[model samples]
Target: MSNRPITPLLDKVCCPADLKGLSDDQLKQVAHELRQEVVSAVSETGGHLGAGLGVVELTVALHAVFDTPRDKLIWDVSHQCYPHKILTGRRDRIRTLRQEGGLSGFCKRSESEYDAFGAGHSSTSISAALGYAVARDLGTAPEAGVGDAIAVIGDGSLSAGMAYEALNHAGHLGKRLIVILNDNEMSIAPPVGAMSRYLNRLYAGAPFQEFKSIAKGAIRHLPEPFQEGAKRAKDLVKQVTVGGTLFEELGFSYVGPVDGHDLDQLLAILRTVKTRATGPMLIHAITKKGKGYAPAETAPDCGHGVSKFDVATGVQKKAPANAPSYTKVFAEALIREARADRKVVAVTAAMPDGTGLNLFAERFPERIFDVGIAEQHAVTFSAGLAAGGQKPFCAIYSTFLQRGYDQIVHDVAIQRLPVRFAIDRAGLVGADGATHAGAFDTSFLANLPGMVVMAAADEAELVHMVATAVAHDEGPIAFRYPRGEGVGVELPEKGVPLEIGKGRIIQEGKRVALLSFGTRLKEVREAAQALSAEGIEPTIADARFAKPLDEDLILGLAREHEALITIEEGAIGGFGSHVAQLLAERGVFDHGLRFRSMVLPDTFIDHASAEAMYAEARLNAADIEAKVRDVLSGATAQAARRA
Candidate 1:
């Protein structure tokens, strides 16, 4: 690797405050250098690339125009914060982006003051900025000028209902806020839904610009007395001609469809918007995802997130010969089932490739639906599909599912709709970190009245769960799996449906019982083996159904073993929480039995290698062994004390 000294301009810019001194030309150069820095950093670290690349000039322009830390600039989704990170006191540490103990992959409030508001999920910035703007308005002493709240959001994010909700509210509240719509025509995949279509029409047609030019020409031709009347006529013409009167009707003074990449235009527009705009205003800026990089630009699925790659050739590193990922396994299983059964359909909220449904989309184009970034809509839409005698497998990442919690609870669970949720990335997502971790799915879904929650112990079990979901037509069911490749088990040609609310004993032993949930079975097995070396043969049971808990299997294990440990890849209220509730209800804990729960610690794990994050959370094999040993040793000490 060639070692290069950090440029002096970059090194000097610790914050947006420092950027105020730079000339506009220097700012443009800085934007270019920042993009290069982002490219270099993400090439090494591997993160959200296209979004950041698209926003480099915007980032530079925003910081140059606004008083950032003071002005509370919130980036929607925050995936595009690489350039923001590079500008705000993190230039030297850019290489460590997304690594454990390094700079966060997204904007994190705890990480830096410049972050303003943390975001991982999209459509949150407008709401967050509005909140800040309101707070600033409420906090203003007579002498203090209004603090600015700038929300930089992507066109893809605008598809979500929450974004529109915030826009409506922001407009009604009449807050001093600036919403910068970064129209890149992409989310991870090409954006879908009506909003994306509207943006395309607005930008592609150039009708607004054409109308504005025509009005100006008309004004030049009109006499002085007629000029004033023509201007009012022009306003009426704009209302009919320019489509953004929708925003104006909502109370926001809508601005431009300006070139986001143009440094001078962005700065000039932002400067004018910053000073002149009274209420909420949206400056629509058109941008290209993966602007500088040609390979990413042309790639149909715009280079959103990528693996570590060779920047020169744009070649992604080849995967090692290993088992197919759980996502791929889930996809294959779904495809096999769909081929056999016509009722089986699939849905993904802006994540066909991520959820491994791209294969399904290609094969069964008619059955699959890609609901852009709108998780709530995807859930309710799936409910509609299910009600229409179709088995809609709403395949979503665990974290993204959080956005549709209300829909799942109300539309699916309450009404008892048979919407199969193929929840991928169901545990701690490495590199993307805590915001993307699927740690709450089990806990949240389990509490829903009629919801059936299952966790896959391995790829094979994931296939079984998919079959189980297909077979069950009573209520909402969710099957969760991790982010990476599955264990090297050969996939069965046909998936066999599993018995609902049942668990199987993987290994039978004595003294201690290790109840494993999800893909953490591998670690549990290793920990059990280590315990065996110490003459403690622990029983290992895979609690397949998180909600139902396999009560018979759990009670049997609790009675047979001296101590019980429930392990899951989620937070406190998940599988472990269910197990705890079961044990308490059965009066098993009345004997004062030695019980321990192994759940992800109540902390936001940083971006890092999966192994490293697991190790940090003490969920890795070694850490699992240590925890098991500690619990067993504690049981021994307690026994001695009782005696």
Candidate 2:
């Protein structure tokens, strides 16, 4: 408490209802205190700081003006929900963010009733808020008190096609919905695409200076009798602010590019919208990312995401780098490949930094594409590039890649377009939880015909896999690697492409075989070492390609070993399932062979450290050792009776 910022006003507020008691001036004070509290909490916990900081005033104004839980307030890509969470009675656990058993970094529906919709991925909020509006209009649950449905979406989130789809539909349906465009002009990476440019143009012109007056005096807010004043206001809007064109053309009554950090302006705008809004409306709020904090404002990415840092200096206390991250290894390997082949290009869906393609872009700016938050577009765009003869590596996080599945199947896989997918965060990612976990890409991608799926065992393997993806031109090929630092293996000076559809023998032994996939080979080796201490030298192999399933190696392992256990950092119907299908087809299972497939649990694992999550899934080193022992002990007892 000594180090904590004093928040006298914020302390009095337990929920949004408490905010309603405060005077408008008091609400401004609360916003000030709340920003400090958010910065202080995030400084201790190390989660998304700048986004939450930016929305401090918006969060306060929304809660102060509208009746929440009753009025569904949806946050698009709710990484900005930390301040919202603090105001909605989650402040005590605020410092526990992104930790095991702690609050989620994003808005979760189950976390609270105040969290109207769960949003991990961007551009879903408008759709959800529309659903709430329709449901309320139709009186689906009057007892639930579903009132005004408001979606607070960032301008960056607007880049996705879904937001516009929802906008178009809401306009056509003519439902009373509120879409607050929180335009900070930054979403993870700096904004991209036409939507970003259009938003900038909205703020750039002097026309915006007159938009607030016309917007505030618009017909919707006035009584039905003041019809002439409303018409005049509407005409004035058309004369200014791009003729109130795009959003107005879409059916939504477009509101101002208001000052988002101005508590008074936000309160005035929101109060008007809440009380008088009769149809779909879009409120454009201009706010600064890292609004109050000097460290975040000056830092690159505006401190989009940060490690636990000192409040005074803003210097992060990162662990000593023992090994380079897998992202770095992939970036360097891709750079090497790009150096060799000019056609080797990259595409990322608003995650150049997250996917390490920002590093790639530093060297090959012309070849790299940051397609904003539009994953579906990114996938098909890469397919177009591949069809045109350039070797396109569609680098995307495994979780986000789910958005582009239809494109992958229809455009890349079916067409045999030879598009390389550099799938990062390919396993249970820490902090972000089940919503952001890369747990299902293998199952999804491998199921597609002509799609080659491979997972790297270590950083060196990742280097080789990058080379392999660059070389593979037969069909669509993908290589997956998890988040964080590697196993400290020495990287090759240059990546040498590995033979396709082959598994490598790490160590050869007898009774039991441990077939590992992805970065779990590190754990498999540790388990093998522990087993060796007990006089059980297990056969260890790295199943490099999940889709291809090195048949010869798998068959040989089944023939030689008494028990075969397949391990992967993926869900069911992935690598282990493919191996099972192979063994069953070969009639290996008919010989009473002990087979077990280690996968992520059927349930969604919550936010935790990657190691802890793996342990919960029972795919950790100790868990592997136990599983091997359990399989062998049971097998040995049964064999003794047969002997």
Candidate 3:
């Protein structure tokens, strides 16, 4: 509160409408104030810092010129919507970012009308904006009154195939749409691919200070009232070509490579394009990620994402890690496998750093591939690698892997390719919320035939799973691990390949058997200890493989224990469902076995800490303990009825 900046110009602005009243100089002042507010707020409540900082001037200029909430302004993968959120009457709640019961880190349609299209994934903006433009043309929602549809996409987003698909379609449709290329030359990671290179050339060749064209003068020279006579027919087709660029080829009137931070240049270019654009138009604005903040600007990731930090020093106030993170563990295990086998290579779809493949890339640079933001290609490419007798480990985040599901099914599953899918962030991820949560991967992957699905109970288990994936050249195998640190378990010096489709018992006890999958075993163990206190002493068995079902272990648990409870960090149709199906088919339920599955609720959870999210999901230690007691009581009731 003490560090909050004085914003005389910005204080007057209540909404985007208020921005329209401010002079260009005052708007520039507002942008400066907005940047200060962003930096200050993020220092207390960390979130996407660099992206918001990058687009301060662009955000101000767009709101100042365009009629948003009416004219659909879509931000591609709207992580940078924090400043936009602040300007659109949400500054009061800015400090509560990424906290429980607070504002979401990403743009949400439910949160505000100004956020035209909600996005947590990248490269969907062009398609969404095009849909809005088409809807406006078709008079689909006349009463709502949608105007010029604008998509502000980053340079890295263009690397995805979806953006180009929309571009190709938009060119064909020839609608009055607008696309702003927010060319920061990076997206979370330093961008790669031909598209990134092409954009780089555009950025390098263009005069950074000026617009690509003198757009205002051209619009001025054209007469507003064209003749209705036979002579008017000659100029029917508007021969408007701002510049012969790539966007022009896509049927968009190309405008910039303009200085995004320069308010005068941004306002002028936006205003000129806003008036003159008939068909689809593109304005390329070059911006520096984390522009104002020196600490962020100089950093490797440009402070892409951060924890709460001191404003002066820019040092994060993170709690000391008790154990290595699951990501690091995964990277270390993967590196070990790669070292032992020349055929063992890694592939990541734009998330080398996020998936911990960056570490792998440092050692075996030639063997590692960072395919830029294209998960679909990454999956099929790995499948191809496997087909060529190479063990390609496709390291992707669980949520991101969903994008490549069709490829996984068609390319990997059908052929039974041994593409080791290292699914990172495999459970209820915090902050990024429901969109980024890896809830469905288990269900989706396990459903496929010949697919081996395994979840790591701890960092040590993760090592074995990596080894298992490498050794198993039979079919497609996947191993999932959660995002944060492990429970400080001592890791093995080298991983031993696990026996396929088998489970290991942790604690053999009496009345109830707790069948655990994934990282939830930690909570299960805690519940067992608490249950031991109550004289319950429930048995705990880690179900290492989800797909293959571990039939012998599962059936033994069902027959031996009075009650059996299955726990997993996945949704309904995953491990528990598979176990349920097995028991049902084998008539275990018919033999009076009291079975229950504890899973994430059939609802989309909002952003919170992983602990808070698990509480809401009702899959914590207490919840597990409660389920065991409840089931045991039910089993006793059944026994009394039999007597």
Candidate 4:
């Protein structure tokens, strides 16, 4: 609040309707104010900064030109929707982004009517927009009275196969759809793959740059009957020297490479497109990711994601780290393994920094491969590398790996390819919320045959897991670790691999046993301490491998303890479910051994701090102790009644 910038023009605009009343000159002021507001809001909230700043003029133009809600404007990934949110009557709640009971960081359909589609994952806008277009044509979506469906997508998102698939269908249908390709030459990481290079070449050529005005002038002069054909011919000529030919061939009329920051240009072009007849038109607008603000514009990644920072200095206020991050630990461990093994290589799906592959890339530059925003390709590509006798570690976030699941099952698991999966952010991530939660990887991967799944309890254990992934070339193996820093533990000089299916006991106790699968071991220990203070010393053990089921340790605990509780930081069908199946098959339940599985609740928990989210999920230390008491007390009462 102290750092909020003055936005006199932006203050008057409550909605898109207010924006329509402004003149072109006034709109320019609004755009400038909007950019300032976005920077100020993100400086306070510390969410996605660069993307929103990039699309300020485009947001203003789209709202001004189109009849929203009816027109159905969809933002791909929707991380860049902050500017859109402010203009669409959500300005009052803009400061509360990514906080509990506040506005979501990403778009949510339930949040507002202006939010035409909810999105977290990238490259989905075009597909959803095509659906809207089809629905409008079929008269199935008459409730909102759809007019046009416009998909605003980023350049990096074009790498995904789904986008192309949607484009192909949209073109074939010949429906009135508008796709604004916001080519900022950046995704999370500076883009990778052929598509990025193609986009780069599009704006780089001098001929393509000159063709924009020339083609527009030529098309306007052509006879009304000849205009359509002449425009296609010009597009074909432009495609020969520049990019967008790929999109054109897929069957859409391509326009621009327009300057995104120029409000006059954006407004004129958008207004023209809104009036003209179109069959799947793609407006390729060239933009700088962090356009308006100098601090973000100059910064690497354009301040893609930031913590709360000083506005004048542009220096972020980051919390001091108490321990080594799980990401860094994994990276260093992988570097160690790569030093020993020349055959090892790393792969990431456009998230080198996010997954800690940036550290590995520094060590083994040629060996690291970033496949851009293509997770499916990353998985299958890793499988191919493994097939070629190279140890390929596909370092991907657990939530992102969901996109590559089919490849995991078909290419790696079925073939028993020795691909190592370094699954980062394996539990409920704070701020990013349910859309990004790594809750289902454990459940999905554990069920796959020849797939080995492991989760680290802390930093030191993560090192060992990395080593384990390196040494074990048996099949497709994955090790998951949560986001942020580890639970401060002493580090070993080097990690040594563990036995395939073995688990180690943390503490020995009496009547009740608490079996933990992932980072929840810390909470289990805290719960155990609380129980001990009350004269109940509960046993705790870490089930390192959820897939293999640490049979000896789990069965032994079931046999000796009066009641056993399994806890994991995943969904219902994950580690706990696997443990229960193992116990039931062993006839442990028939002997009246009270068993309970603690997992995340069925509903999706919203954005909040990690501790608060865990509390909401009932997976905190207090909840753990309560569950143990409930199970044990119930068994004690039943025994007394029987006696």
Candidate 5:
């Protein structure tokens, strides 16, 4: 709190309406203060740093130019909404970003009325904004009406197919909508694909830029009668170059390649578009990611995602790791596999570094493919690679893999292609919140026929799972591992592939059984220790495969124990659901047995520490101990009655 920034101009701005009467110069000062404020806030609360810094001016300009709340303003991905949050009455809670019961890291509609639509996923803004535009038109009177629908989407987000689909639909509808293409030249990783190159060509000094400037400047000076002709001449000249003509063909009135940081330019263009444009309009504003701070500007990824850092030195304060992250373990293990088998290749959808495929790319440059924010394409491309006899490992985050489910089913699962899925962030990821949680991946993927699903219990287990995926060529196989460091277990020099559908018992005990899946094995072990303290001495087993339920092991456990409890990091329909189905099918439940399934709660858990989230979901070691105690207590009471 002592390190809080002194924001004089921004102090006056409690909301967007407060910026209404400020002069252009004062507004510029506000942008400067706002950028510093965002930097200070995010420095304390580690989150998306660069993206918010990149859009400070644009956020101020949009709020000043457009009537927000009434006029819907949607942010694509919404990682860049920090500055917008500051201006929209959430300033008080800005420092509480991504904490439990605090402000969310992304724009959440439930969090604020100013956030027109909630978005943690990318490329959905255009479609959502178009809906708002249509809704506005459908209203009978201005009193019940929406003013405007504006979507501020990044260039990286534009790489997704959904953005293009929305553009095509918006074009067809010809609704009154405004789409601001915030071309920052960087995403989580550097922007990829032909779309990024095309955008580069637009802003890159070509003959069109000089011509555009001269034509615009000359048009204002022209007599009233010649001004219309000169504007037509400018449009014809713009068409000569392949800059914004693609958007024009999409039925949008294309309006930029404008400087996003320039307040006067943004204000002028937005004011003109607000008053006159009838159909969909696209404002392509060029800006740098991590524009303000020198450290952020020079750093690779443009300091896209950062930990809590010192504002002065820009050095992040990261906790010392006890063990290698599951991501790194998977990457190193995959690299070892690839070295032995040249058929192994990697594919990522705009997240090479995040998925630890950057390590793979560094070693096997030619073997790695970055599909650039197109998960659907990445999945099918991996399927194609497998079909061509190459062992392709499609590395994607669990939450993001949801986007390519159709392709996963149609192209990979149906065809029975042996495309290995390396699912990172496979459970309740911290800070990013429920939208980014890998809660549903196991549930969704396990349901598909011929799909083999496995979860790693720790970093050591993750190494083996990677080896298992590499060894398996029967059909599509997936292995899920969570975010952050593993539980300090000594890793094998190299992973030895485990037999399919087999689980190992940690220890043999009595009465109750704890069937653990994924990273929750550590907690299960701790719970067992607590139970042992109480003289319960419960049996514990790690269920490695969710799809092929280690049938014999599960049945043996059910037959041996009076009460059985299954635990996993995923949602209810995941490992627990499969286990329950197996028990019911085997008629194990026909005998009087107390059973409990510990999984994530039905409601979405908000941003918090991993421990806090699991505690709230009642899947913590303490919760597990309590559940076991209750089950044992009930069993003992029933035995007394029978005796």
Candidate 6:
């Protein structure tokens, strides 16, 4: 280890402006130090480790070349931005990365001037950069000095249609934009699609140095007519063989298949492209995920994101109990269902492992589809599978599903296909923070006509819901579950489908009734227990289907109880909102019945432990108890005054 600490160098950088004064050598040194800092910081915080590590050199090269804060640098997905964050004045608070009230794990424009655009989802960089480029051309802010728009997108993100859409538009419009294709052969998983295959073929060819030298010499000696003819011939050859010809045809000047890890090669190529290339340019740089760490390199999953681990041993800290995660439960249930039915198939957007479909993939390789971070494609593709008489379970995180919202509405709901959506991470996702939070899926999906939306109250309920989704072939059905383990519920041999639009009463009581949905059942139970001790007995009902609204159960609860509270693990427009809307529509509130909605606060919550994040959002037992007490006290006061 180098004894010289990089603290001083890192401390001096408040933004990219400070980096402008540093020499190339210093920048190189800073890049190395930044990597070290990232490794060290993430060892404590535990976030998207591999991505940040992979982008160390790229981050250094970009800042060293572009006048950031003036020249826009939009990082695709933004997970690979720890090094960028370190160099851009946030070093002092780096340890607080992904923690509550601390620095965000991904790039945030509000955090600093250097973060030209905010991103959490993949494949949005090119579009964002194009918008910036257009704004510059239209003189959106003349005094802001928007010099250039650069988009750094991963090869995995290239599989998305949105990325291609942006590329097509950028090429046609002839905007002065730069797109750096970070070809790491992985995007949370191995890259997929025709583009990935083409890029691999390009990588297999001879080095760019040899090709460039040969082309330069051949072009220099030819006569004007022959030169033009040779240029046409060379372009024809490029079109026949080079994968980048597609980008070129799209109107971008294509460059490289360069070694991303080589500092000199990267800088040299970047400098050339920065000056020589006109209009839109695509610079393809090949890199390795988890590049520096030996354990991460050898890990089956590339150590994409890790829990708190020992630096020397790479062993994660063990939790006290051994419980299967919600994802595992869902996968196991799906596997059981699939084994029984030939029509069952699984799909994911480059997240087989994260969505718990790896077990299914291993067992039924032919039936599994890893669509590579293209959520829109995954949803529509599943709709196609459903149309073909195959039962498709599109397992995607709730946050990622936001990207495919339109497709879900247009392809699945409009046609009323029986696409089973196994919505994972259906609530506040810790560490990855606001961008990755599964907040809006419940709300968004619930509103779509003919959409069947349900939330698992526990792990066992998740199993049952999986069964329900598989059995229900009437239309698009979705079941959401939170991240992490189930509440140690006993495993069921197999799941049985439940009645549609029905709710079950968990505990019976009197004066007040609590309508709980999703994982909030535990908190509601806890609050009920505390209230029981206080002589305020409450009834509990698990409202399974958000869309169906369990009208009879809700209306009965409304009429029976003095106060009815609806709780869910989502944002404003989710389960709670739907319940309120349903009750209001039926004139349930016309009797002046007291009602309260427990939901995630309107503001974005930062990354932390799931429990800590929930508590901060005031969605925990204590918070629920407080709300119940407040509502009860108000009701009591009103009754006493009336008497």
Per model, state how many residue pairs clash: 0, 0, 0, 0, 0, 1
Instruction: Single out the weakest 10-residue window by summed lDDT for candidate 4.
Output: 218-227
Q: Which of the two candidates, 1 or 5, achieves a greater TM-score against the reference?
A: 5
| Candidate 6 residue-pair clash tally | 1
TM-score for each predicted model, relative to the true structure: 0.92, 0.97, 0.95, 0.97, 0.96, 0.92
lDDT of each: 0.84, 0.89, 0.88, 0.88, 0.88, 0.84
lDDT of 4 by residue, 100-145 (tens): 8889989999999999999999999999999999998898996758
Residues 240-351, model 5: lDDT tens digits: 3435767877877665577788787777767767766667878888888998998899988888889999999899999999888999999999999999999999999999
For residues 130-246, could you state the per-residue lDDT of candidate 3 as single tens digits?
A: 999999989995597998899999999988999999999998898988899999987989999988877767545435543324333333433431222212112322332223367
Model 3 Cα RMSD, Å? Answer: 3.2
Error of 6 at 470 (Å): 1.4
* Model 5 TM: 0.96
lDDT of model 1 at position 280 = 79
Q: Which lDDT tens digits does candidate 2 get at residues 240-328?
A: 44434688788877766677877766787677667666788778888889989999998889989999999988899889999999999
Q: What is the C-alpha RMSD of each candidate to the true structure, in Å?
A: 3.7, 2.1, 3.2, 2.0, 2.4, 3.5
Worst 10 residues of 6 by lDDT: 221-230
Specify the poorest-scoring 10-residue window by lDDT in model 1.
224-233
Q: Which parts of model 2 have CA positions greater than 4 angstroms off?
A: 207-243
**Model 4 misses residue 453 by how many Å?**
0.8
Worst 10 residues of 5 by lDDT: 221-230
Off by over 4 Å in 6: 1-27, 207-243, 318-322
Better by lDDT, candidate 6 or 4: 4
Task: Give every collision pair in model 1.
Answer: none
- Distance (Å) between predicted and true CA of 342, model 5? 0.7
Candidate 5: stretches off by over 4 Å:
140-144, 207-242
